[model samples]
Target chain A: MIPVLGGSGPVIPSFGSGSSCEQNNGWWCTDWLREHWGDTLQPALVQHIELVAIAIAAGFLIASVLAIAGFRYRLLDVPVGGFADFLYTIPSIALFQLLVPFTGLTVLTVEIALTSYTLFVLYRNMVAGLRGVPEDALEAARGMGLTRVQTFFRVELPLASPAVLAGLRIATVSTVSIATVAAFVVPKGLGEPIFIGLDQNLFKTEILAAGGLAILLALAADVALAWFARAVTPWSRA
Target chain B: MSVLADQFTAHTFVDAFRFIGDNASLMLSKTGQTCELAFAALGIALALALPLGLWLGHRHRGLFLALGVSTLGRALPIIVLIAFGLTVLGVGFWNNTAALVVLGIPPILTNAYFAVDGADRDAVEAARGMGLTERQVLLRIELPLGLPLIVAGVRISAVFVIASATIAAIAGGGGLGDIIVNQASYGLAGVIAGSLCVSAVALLTALALGLVHRAVSRSTTARA
Candidate 1:
């Protein structure tokens, strides 16, 4: 996702990522991070959160719309689903390069990429969620003289809520991990810290430390998401 | 036909041939590299994770957690692992292969654990009541019962590992990904050739695994 478009570098959130303390404070890659690890943590964590938040918000809304359309009309499923599959097949790096011209390497670019990813897994889950509504329930709602819209809101959505939440949890964890790549283009977040560590080609220990932290963040996200999933669905025990 | 269209069509075909000719030797070695990485990782995954998985299934029934955790590997993309591994351990085949193994482990481990745990609990009890030791029960009843699931998981893991191993080639892991990346700069021919290499490895491994799965599953099914 190296920036190749016309404009500023990646659309990282408001955070100072470009400055290097190596020269000013002789932090080098290694000790610089150690000396000011707290300084790096805020920006990286912020960037990470921003990337994930943007991605999930966009993805779920779009996926929900698509799911509704698909549920209403079966014919739209193949064409739209096929296209989503196509997006999923293309490597993340290649897709980013192609979009750089339009999105200009910002949070928007990363958001779109991460959102597209969520589609592959989340769309299926969304379909499953919607399809899971019992037909008898729908018929009962119909017999009660409820409109299609009302049935969907009351009978369908509530029944599908757990499945949708499960899908959201999966999408959340997936987005958090995938969002790391946004740092390849953008200027903010933990990715920048890790990328800078990789790029400067200095501070081996410091880079390793960053790497360890990234993995830790990844594990933490997994646990938190698992907790969230369990909270939403008491039946889905590990 | 317009000469431009004809020439373009001819160019695509010729480019395809030339790409294959140019990378024939490189393709073979690269294929070997990917195969070696996939197979070795499969072996290691089986050795390290399979027994543990089976044990978890049999003992306190912790395999479910193993299955849940392994799902993490599947959720994350292999490309990211390749990228991260390159930075962490410099760039080379060993590191790439190691990363592939790490990526490959979850599926195999999950399958092994579940298959063993899901083995006919009745038969397991029968074997136990017959005065069989835990090890004997596992070796004779559990292993044989769980063989199908374990094999199926291995097959799936093998295919995934092979496909993923291509990305490792980017970091000089010496596989089809090298071809994919190499010819990618060359245009359509490079893309086709590299794609072919990846597809070949994936499909071939998948087919082999399928055969293995069928044999193992059939035996287990017959026993049941």
Candidate 2:
């Protein structure tokens, strides 16, 4: 029976074995991974990466355009922020349920929701970075006879790289995490194994392996973006 | 698009509203549970984060520790944490609350550290010049000045916790998620109703906290 909000009787807590992957005999069995790796982990990882990349790339493009336009029309600021905030407030499961009926549990459905989540983080930071360009720096660019276009590309954008990249780092890491929920809509990613393992009582190995991989993916993405940010903003180091 | 449109049809709208009315008590109870879960987690987080954050911020020590905690907090997915809690610690309120408290800590700690550490140097120097004791300066001066951003941090954590409490339903922790996940049996109307309730609660919480944050910041600035 579905547990109603005010159901009668005390709710019983279910227990699963308390085992760590490092100490557990389950995940430590190389034979188990070897058997499952080809069909399970590899494809799931690939799909996970694909979903994250598409969402982040699309989010970045949309946020960049919106941020640029926001600079032109100050009126866009509050509405854009409000819309993003509204989207951010929606629960992930509710979001998936709402979209699935329309988009039919496809990657597009997942991407739409995922991309929307990124807008709040990306748009806010990008705008802040753009607006944060020093007035003196702008004056110098104008004094040097740089056109509005040249100054934007050469001065404003480069100066804003740190903030924008920080946003990108945040968006990318979060995307990796939220993308796990994609397993509910479509049979893809580490989430598939994790959820399946949970439902089937397949022990700690599947859950640990998939969850650990997702965490590792987030860490790796964050580090890579940090390195990229440093590479692009060499003057910050100077 | 049709499905989205279908959801707002007069029949569905009536059904949704009626469902909400019929389940009003249950809805309120569930919302209460979600609120309890969030506040309990927040309380635990504040207890741990406040002292640590204040001490470090006051001493200006362990900037790296602050950064490291924030990074780990972001990188650790809540779902993953819940899954770990369920499997490792066994499914109960304690495990679920532990996971949420972990989720709530980073923002509180990071913002508190930033607030106290970044308090106006000149004002702090003046306080010191007046022969104010360290404890007095922190309690009387720094705490009041840092209150706004600290509240802002709590606002962030609060919103996050409220929205995330829905997931607690999955682990037998009871929230609106129980209704949400059972949409198959209750029909789309029930799902929509639950979704609306969750959204309303989350948005209202955020709005309320945001107002408080604004009020605090405004008063703090007015004093300055």
Instruction: Highest DockQ: give the candidate number.
Output: 2
**Candidate 1 regions with alpha-carbon error over 4 angstroms:** A1-31, A34-41, A62-91, A94-112, A127-160, A183-189, A234-238, B1-29, B63-68, B71-91, B118-160, B163-170, B179-200, B203-215
lDDT of all the models against the reference? 0.68, 0.81
Q: After superposition, how far is residue A69 of candidate 2 from its true place, in Å?
A: 1.6
Which 10-residue span in candidate 1 chain B carries the lowest summed lDDT? B1-10
Clashes of 2: 0
Interface alpha-carbon RMSD, every candidate? 9.5, 4.4
For candidate 2, write residues A1-238 as lDDT tens digits. Answer: 9666876777765544333432453634565567778888889889999999999999999999999988768899889988988888777776777776667768898899989999989999999999999999999999999999999999999988888999999889878988887786788887887787667554566777788888899889998988888888887751
Question: TM-score of B chain for each model?
Answer: 0.83, 0.87
Worst 10 residues of 1 chain A by lDDT: A18-27
